[model samples]
Target: MKKTPHASPAAAAFVLAAALLGAAAPAVARDNPVDPVSNPDKLDYRDVEARRPDFKEPFLRDGVVSRPERFREIKPGITQAQVLAVLGQALKQQRGALGTEWDYHFKFQMPQSANYLVCQYKVVFDDSQAVRSAVWRRRQCLDLLPR
Candidate 1:
């Protein structure tokens, strides 16, 4: 019978390292565009709004009363997977690996009244598919955040 050839120790190690680095490539490729010194409130929302017409659902137009706590969990530099964990999938947009933005409609219960305020939320991603910034169509909706 013919004997099988085994890889040398150094070759085995090189192959292992390559495999590990390949596995980590996706995470390493994510880009963080947030400027730590700037106000998060100032992020531009127009870019997301420009794509609003792509969605077919009216919920994004009318807004839904979602739990305010979930929105608060989102932060800059997080990966799309993390955002998916916090907010689940975007309401009506099909977010692919190359998609640059995700949109949502959220309404919050007022602090002292029964009225619910409708708001549009947008999350923008860089070409690397990492979270760049998040914005609200109604700036006042930020008040819903817990102090």
Candidate 2:
């Protein structure tokens, strides 16, 4: 029987080492990386990026959903009507020795957490129906609450 040609073990190992070295070599950026011939219509990438709008405004908030930013406008002595305009409506209300307290609950979401947080904004109004105090607090979801 005719013997088939086969590379020696040493030759095979050398070939493998050469291939690994070539792959491990760091890639060098070409001076003229863009191919004008391949791309018939050459476009300046930098110019396109420069024309794009860079938004710097805040996208996340820490207030109620209806109008979170309005919370900042709340202050003592503000009429109940004004608070209502800002927070929409209280989820629960009750009259106490201190004053009439209103409860505002909202589902607060944070970028880092996978669960939704429960936030409560309690606004206390004096007998005159003017806000006397406002308090805000946040708690994790019921499922996440520690026993």
lDDT of 2: 0.60
Instruction: Tell me the TM-score of model 1.
Output: 0.53
Top candidate (lDDT): 1
RMSD to the native, candidate 2? 22.0
* lDDT per residue as tens, model 2, 35-146: 3332222211111122225444332223354434556678889999998888888877887556788876666454467645555556788889998877654222222322
What does the lDDT read for residue 146 in candidate 1?
70
Q: Give the TM-score of candidate 2.
A: 0.46
Clashes of 1: 0
Reference-based TM-score of each model: 0.53, 0.46
Q: 92-127 in candidate 1: lDDT tens per residue? A: 554534357787777788889998787767787877
- Candidate 2 local lDDT, residue 9: 100
